[model samples]
Target: MPYLLPPPRAAQPQRLLAPTVTHLARLLLTHAPAIPPLLTAILPSSPSLLTPLLSHLLLSHSPPLPALSLFRRLLELPHFPVPESALPVLLRLLARSRRYAHHSFQLLESLPSTHPHLLSVPALSVIISTALCASAPGASFAAAVSCFESAAAVWARAGRSFGAAELNALLRVFCARGRVAEARALFHRYCDAYPPDTRTFNTLLLGFKEAGHAQALDLFYHDAVLRGFVPDAVSYCVRMDAYCKKGKFLDALQLLDEMRKRENCKPTLQVFTTLIYGAGIVRDAARARRLFDEMEQSGVTPDRGAHNALMGAYVRARDLQSGMALMSEMEQKSFGLDDVTYNTMLCEFQRAGDLEGIWKIYTKMTGSGFMPRTRTTMLLMKVFCENGRPDLGLELWDYLIGKGCVPHRHALDVLVTGLCCRDVVGEAYRCFRELVEMGMAPTERAFRVLEGFLKKKREFGKIDEIRQMMKAIQLEEHQAEEEAA
Candidate 1:
């Protein structure tokens, strides 16, 4: 089989100069039939750079189904070079984009019949690993277990057994769902085929730390060391994080000491920052300050993240002045404050009923080219609603909607809940109706708030209307749920 030579460079000399993904996407969209040949010709030149081009197309330009269609076309071609390097990137993009993650797995099932060259232990391992992060059926523990079952079915049908890494990813998923015992059971079941590695144990430790099972951390470490897995920086970080989380500050400090004594296992910036946050969490600002100084003394420069950790500690301690001073220092060092900084300040000022303070930070956030995030908008709107400034909340809503930006469902929920609480039930009703029309469900909290208002007013007719609407919505939700399954 002859290779697919490059398309006539003479015909498109300008393409050689730019070769931008956006430009290629335009070409593919306009000349859909040419995608396979274009890919066949171009991919061989630089698979590494061009692999990301396909991802850019999927994530930035095209939807999943159509983008996969193009990929399928390339795979089906007569002389196309196999897109081995690119497939991982494509699969990862699919897994992370919540609307399209399941399609990523579906790609795995399609591989045997269509693109077996793309099917391998390594590729499927990556797909399985990425799929672990994708949501399960219902986001419950049972859903998580079921997700593993479905993944196993996909594995069996693909005619391949999982490698250590894939199995570890599956184990991580189970542990993350607060089903640590299930993860442990699954690991033991497959230990002979794929024994736990350092990365595997690291994930297990992180999962326990996240799930708030500090006690499990020690058990896991003992098991790992007994099994001869060399403890690495990741191993210590997990335990240190667990220690910090559990308010074992001195213990966390002791672990830092132990880490220092180990050859090639010095405490990282992450370790120091973790301790600082832990100190902040338990209101040990003095210890946190000492850790910062210690970090600098150890030749680890305090980064923006370190400053943010201290700011968070100050916020927790209700010391806004100190937090502001910390912010000023970060700025003087040209360390840009992130959404975390602004959101923390916004929350602190909100608690103090300092409306002007809230506005001041918000203005700075917006002026500094920071787009409003979901949490930032929700809390800001909630403050307005709570402090008898629903008008300002509505203004912000209009501003968002005018720019064709959809606020988070929770933001809309806050608005409706606030309107009903403030006795603006008619506006709340309008907002609720618009949300439903937009094909997004209002939260049960929003519905209850509105229903409470209508009941207090004895609006019997409106109550009947709400009842009917509720039934219809429930039916639609059930049907949609079935369709998704």
Candidate 2:
């Protein structure tokens, strides 16, 4: 206390030098992670320095660092209560990150439930709209419905304040998850509250198409026209799908012609695929082929799905040569062949008892980097069994099991039937026991196969096994009845 030095000279006020906004903006653009610490240091001493720093950070920098921490700090900064200008930046970040935007959403939830500031921010409205569509709290329909309700409430509060893009995103998410009722409700709400746009009507029409609600389709068409929402290519596609579903092929063709004449909207690959499927259903492969040719002529590259559909049409027509030809073309074009393609060809060759053709396709599939799926392996095994090659069937079976392919009940049934046909009652009984252990019931056909095998071989031991399987079946039925009661 006695060692007092000369009185410290009163601190002189240095000339204040304000940092240029452009300099701050440049720093944010060039270096994002360093700005947060620099801003935090200056923000406490000179509160007014926050606006420019935050504005620059939010606008110029993407995925602002420590977003959650920064938002919490902003809430505590008495001098810089909620930067209203930064809300848009926050919303944009949320939209980009999607499910990863959890931290930002948590900050939003921290605000007062009825915060008036959030009501005024259009960006906040957009974020809420997206969250409703994208976020699934639990993997259940009820949970999804709850999310939709929450989103609807936010949209209601925003009134006519949201934009067309936000509405379209919401409607798409709803339709994708089969929430058609909610989609319709939101669509109606948008139309009643906001300016009607062609995109808005298109979104609603698509929802009806996805839901398979034929009645709502005509109403949407009329309402869209009355609202001066011109139909586009996508609009025509939706109508086409609807007409096809209702078996109104003539109406669908008329709509297609009208679209071509009025809107110059050319058919897409998807449009042709739909037509092919419809033709296949009605057993009109000729029309399907015409459309396929038209699709090729129009410069649209056929995809694997298109090729598969064509192959399916040929198979339905019993034209194996044509189907094989299309598969060859698919291979030349480097379109990836999936299990379905291989399985289809395998089943066809098996039916024709063309083992050489089957092996050729199998080798080709493996050579082209296509791994055989469980169904493919099962189909091949069945072919082996049917052609009296149990040794080959057993080899395929071991390979599938080793690769962790859990054979389905149908596959087991086929194996059992094949064994019984060869008078191998012991093996058939063993297979039936294994299937029962795996919680699959033997079908009546399996029982008949066992009985026929025992009769042919005069084997009472196999008959005893069959009786045991029947008792097990009866026990399971009784348990199910008790549960129902």
Please provide TM-scores, in order, for all candidate models, with all chains considered together.
Answer: 0.67, 0.49
Residues 1-485, candidate 2, lDDT per residue (tens digit)? 33111222333453333554434343333343343465555556655544555444343223434343454565566555455555555555455443334444445545544343553334554454445545565443344444444544665654524556656666666775556777777777665555556666777787787788878888879886896777877787788877777777667778767866875678888777776766665667787788788887987777888888788778777788988998989878988788778888888787787787787786676456343765687777677677676545554444433222334556666777777667666777776665554334667777778777887888788788777877886796676546534
Each model's C-alpha lDDT? Answer: 0.69, 0.63
Q: Candidate 1, residues 1-485: lDDT per residue as tens digits?
A: 43221121222122233555545654554444345466556655654555766655543323334455566666666666656677776676565445556676667776665555565544554554555555454554454445555656666666767567776777776666666776777777776877667788787777788788988778878887897878887888788888877888788878888988989887888888988998998988887888988998888888888889988888888888888788778878999988688888888988887777787776676556454656888888888777666656765665444332445667777887777767888877776665554334567887787888989989778778766777787896576456557
lDDT of 2 at 257: 72
In candidate 2, where is summed lDDT lowest over 10 consecutive residues?
1-10
Give the 10-residue window scoring lowest on summed lDDT in candidate 1: 3-12
